[model samples]
Target: MTEKYRERVCNGYDHVLTIDERLYDVRTDHQHLLIFKNRAFGRVLALDGVIQTTEADEFIYHEMMVHVPVLAHGSVRRVLILGGGDGATLREVLRHRTIQQAILVEIDPSVIDLCRQYLPNHSMGAFDDPRATIVLDDGLHFLQTTHERFDLILTDSTDPDGPAEMLFSRPYYAACKASLAPGGVLVTQNGVAFLQLDEVRSSARHFNALFRDWHFFTAAVPTYAGGIMAFGWASDNPELRQQEATTLQRRFSQTGMTTRYYTPEIHRNAFALPQYILDAIGKTSP
Candidate 1:
C-alpha cells in the first residue's frame, strides 16, 4: 500500500516531506503531533501542521541555540529551557561541564515520549541525564511561580502562534526576565525574519523594554524552509555579544566543542544583521 502525505504551509513556505513510515499520529490537548520518517530529513516531527525538527540538520539548530550563548557567557551553572519537548536543547545544554542543573519546562509530555521513541538521535538520552529535571506544565505559570533563578534561559519554542503564542508575549518576556539571575542571558527561537517580520519586530520591542541590551543572529537551517533562521539574544549586559574575537576563539577551543554550522567566526558575525531586517525591527544598528 502506498501511504499519503500532506503539505504544511508555514511562514509562506509549502513544506512537503515524503513519509516512508508514520510512527505516531495523535491529537494532544495542545495540538496535533505527527512523527514520520523521510529520505530527505530522516525522522521528522511536526506539530499542528508545522515542522519542528528533523534528524538530518537538527544539529545546526540545536548547536547554534546552545553553544552561541554558552560560549558568549563563557560560563554558566543553572539553565532553564521552555517548549523544547524533543530534548535536543537540553541535550546541548548539558554538554557544558559547568552546568550543575538544567530545568526543562514542556507543556506537552507526549512530545517527549514520541521523540524519545522515534527521534532518538535528536535527544540522545538527554532526558535521563542526572543534571536534567523535566517539568510537565505550562511554562508561563512555572515562570510566574518558581523562585529559582538561572544563569541562562533558552526558549527553544515553536513559532509565535498556537500554543506557543504566549511564549513571545510581553508579559512572558517580563516573567523570563524576573526568573533570571543577575547577569543572566535569555535566548529565543525567533523563526525566519525574512518571512515573520511581525514576530521579530514585536519581540524586539518587548525585549528592548525589558533588557539593557537585545540583539538577533541568524543561522541557515535547511529544514526550516526560509533563507535563514533568526535567534533572539537578550541580556542586561551589552558586552556579552561583543566579546573580542580572540577571547571567543580561546573559550571555544577550551570547550573542545565541534559543530556543523556554528563557529567562532559565525558567532562573531551572526549579529551582523542585514539592513532590511534592522529596518523591520526598527533598529538602526546591529
Candidate 2:
C-alpha cells in the first residue's frame, strides 16, 4: 500500500512525501511523532506535522553543524548539544577524537528512543559510544544548574515555538554564554535567512549583546526549504571563525573523516554571507 503525507513546514509552502509504509504513529507528551518509510527520503521522522530529518540528506545537516565549530575551535574537548534527540549531532561530535566528552540534553527521551529504533542509520551507534552522556532534561535548566564548562556548545533546537522557544531567548543565551569555557564557541540554527530574516536579526541582536564576536553562516539542506538555512555563530575569540583555509584543510585531513557535503573549502565559504543576509543581520555596508 502507498500513501501521501504533506507538511506545511513554513509559511506559504508545503512539503509532501510518499509513504510506502507507516511504521510508527503516536503522540508523545511533547508532540505528535511519525515514522514512515519513503522511497525518496528513506526512513522519515516528523514531529507535529513538521519534517524533522530524513535518511537521504540527514548527513548534510548533521555534518555541517557539528564539523564547522568543532574543526574551527581545533581544541574542542567537551561539547553540550541542546535538543538533538535524533543523535545525528552527537554522532558527528564523536568523530573528533579531540572531544573527550559529549553531553546531549534532550527534553524528550521518547524522541531519542524512537529515533534510535527507527532511524539508526542517522546515529549509527552513536548513543552507545563510551564518551557520550545522555541527559534527559530541559536544555535551559541543565545549563542553569550545571557548573560544567564546555569548549563548544551547539543548540540543535527546533524553530522558536513550544518548549524550544526559550532556547532562542536572551536569558537562555545568557546561560549558554556563562557555561562556555574561555574562548569557547556557540552555534544555533537561525532558520532560513531568505524567509525568516527576523530570526537572523533577533539572534544577532541577542548574541551581539552577550558575545564579543557573533556572525551568521549558511548551509543548504533541501529538507529545510526556503533557500539556505542560517546558523548563528558566537565566540569570544573572533579568529576562530576566520581560520585560514590551509589551517582548516590540514585539521580536516588530520581527522581522516570522509563526508558527503562538508569540505574545508565549503567551511570557509559558508561565512561569505549574501548581501541580503548581511542586511538582515544588520551588517549593511557602512
Candidate 3:
C-alpha cells in the first residue's frame, strides 16, 4: 500500500513514471489538463485522460499542427496561432523560412512561461525569433477584433472546455472565416475522432458551413491515447488543393528527417473519415 501510494499518479489520467526520476505527475484540471514535469517533452500539456507523451512524441503534434494546412495553402507568408503555448507549434511554423511573420495568441501566459522554462526543446528559438510575436489574450476575442488577415491560422487548443469552448463555436468559425486572406487556410484540433466523435462531426459541419474547401483529419501521438488525434482544415476556396505557384517547395521529403508520422500523402489520407464520421457529420447538432 505504501508503494502504491508513493508511485500512483494523483491525476485521473493513466500516466506512469517514465523515468520516475525525470518526469513526474504533478496535478490535473480533472477532465481537462494533466500537468506533469519531465526531462523531456517540455511541461504543462493536456492528454485526454489516457496516455501522456514523451519528448519524442511531442514532435508529431508539432509537425502535424504546423505542416499539413500550411503546405496545403501552397505558401504561408503570414500565420496566426491560437492557444499553442507549448511552442511546439511555433517551432514547426518557423521551419519553412519563408514565413514573414507569425502571431501566437495564447490565453494563459503561464502556459508559455512553463513550457519555455521547462520544455526548451519543444519551442526551439520560437520565442526569440524576430518574425514571431506572442500575445497574451483570449483567442476568440482576438479573432473578433483583429482586422488584418493571414495566410494560415492554426488553432492549438485544449479540449472543448474551459477557455477553449468558444474556439469551437459556429460564431467563432464565422469570425475566423471573415478574418482570413482570400486564399488562407485554417486548421484546428477537433478532439479525438474515437470518443468525441459526435462533437468532431458537429464542429466539422460548422466549419464546412463557414468555408469552401474543408476536410477533417487525424494524426497519431503516443501521449494522446492510441497515439490517435483529430484535426479539421478549412479554406476559402478549392484552389488550395490545386497548388499555386509558391517560392517555397510544397512537397515534403522524408529522405533525411526523423518523423514518426505525417507526410505529404499522409495529409490527404488523414481526411478519409471513418464510416461513422461520414454518417454523423450532418446529423450532429451544433
Candidate 4:
C-alpha cells in the first residue's frame, strides 16, 4: 500500500506530514476537521487544511500561552480562554492553584466533542474539571455580552483566516480588552513571525493603540510549520512583562507545577525578538 500524507500550504510554504493512520475526518458546521496518527507527532488535529495541534509539541505552545501570563500577573484568579476548544490551554490554566475559574469560549461544539473523543490525551480530563466552564458560543459574542471580567484572557484562535478571520481584527481585540479586569493581561495567537509577519504587525498596531504596553513573544512549536510562532501580549501594566526572573521563579515555585518548555529563564527570554521580527512589528524592543 502506498503511504498516506497530508499537506498544508500557508504563506507560500508547503508542509507535509505522513499519516500512519486516519482516525476521523469530517466536515463540521464550522470547518473541515481531520484527526490522524503520525509516527512522530502521535495524534494530529487539523482544521481547514491547517495543522492545529499535535501531541508531540503541544506542550511548548500551551505552556507558554498559559503559564507566562499566569505566573507574570502573579494573582490571576479568573481566566477566560477564547477558541481553545482542544482543552490543552484549559488544562494548563487549571494547573495553577490560584485560578478559581476558567471559562473557555469556543465557536464550534464539534471541535470540543470530537477532540474529547479523538484527542483524549490533548485535554487529559481538563473538560471534566470543576473549575472549567465550557461555553459553546462565538468568542466575540461572549466577550461583548459578558459582564464578568477575567484576570487573564488568552485567545488561542487558529490563524487569521476562514472561520477565525474575525478573531484577529481590531474590533475583536477591543472586545477582549473590555472584558479584562484591572491589572489583567491579554495574549493572542499571532502565528509564526517568519511567514505571518503581517498578523504580528496587525496585532501590534491594535495592541499599541489599545494598551499602555504591547509586545510579541516567540516560541518554536514544531507542528506549527513556520520558524518561530509569535504570541501577542497586551496590558496596561507594562511591569507584568518585565518581571524579574527571580520573581517569576518564585511565583512558579509556589504553584508547585512542573512544565516541560516554560521556565522562568525561557519566559524572560521569549520576549527578546529577533531584528527582522522586531522590524516587522515596528518595535525596537519586545
- The model with the greatest TM-score is 4
Decreasing TM-score order of the candidates? 4, 2, 1, 3
Alpha carbon lDDT at 85, candidate 2: 95
Clashes of 2: 0
How displaced is residue 28 in candidate 3, in Å?
A: 12
Model 1 Cα shift for residue 63 (angstroms): 0.5
Across 1-286, the per-residue lDDT of candidate 4 in tens digits comes to 6456555556467888888899999999999999999999999999998899999999999999999999999999999999999999999999898889999999999999999998887789999999999999988889999999999999999888887898998899999899999989999999988877889888988998899998988899998876999999999999999999899989988989888999999999999999998888676862
Clashes of 1: 0
**Ranking 1 against 4 by lDDT, winner:** 4
Each prediction's Cα lDDT score? 0.89, 0.91, 0.70, 0.91
- List model 1 lDDT by residue over 126-174, tens digit each: 9999999999988899999999999999999988778898999999999
Q: Write the per-residue lDDT of candidate 3 for residues 39-140, one digit (tens) a residue.
A: 544343544443323465777777888777777766679999998887888888887677899999987776677667666788888989999999988888
Model 1 CA lDDT for position 281: 78
Off by over 4 Å in 1: 1-12
Worst 10 residues of 3 by lDDT: 1-10
Give the alpha carbon lDDT tens digit for every residue of 105-201 in model 2: 9998889999999999878898999999999998999999999999999999888887688999999999999999999999998887888788899
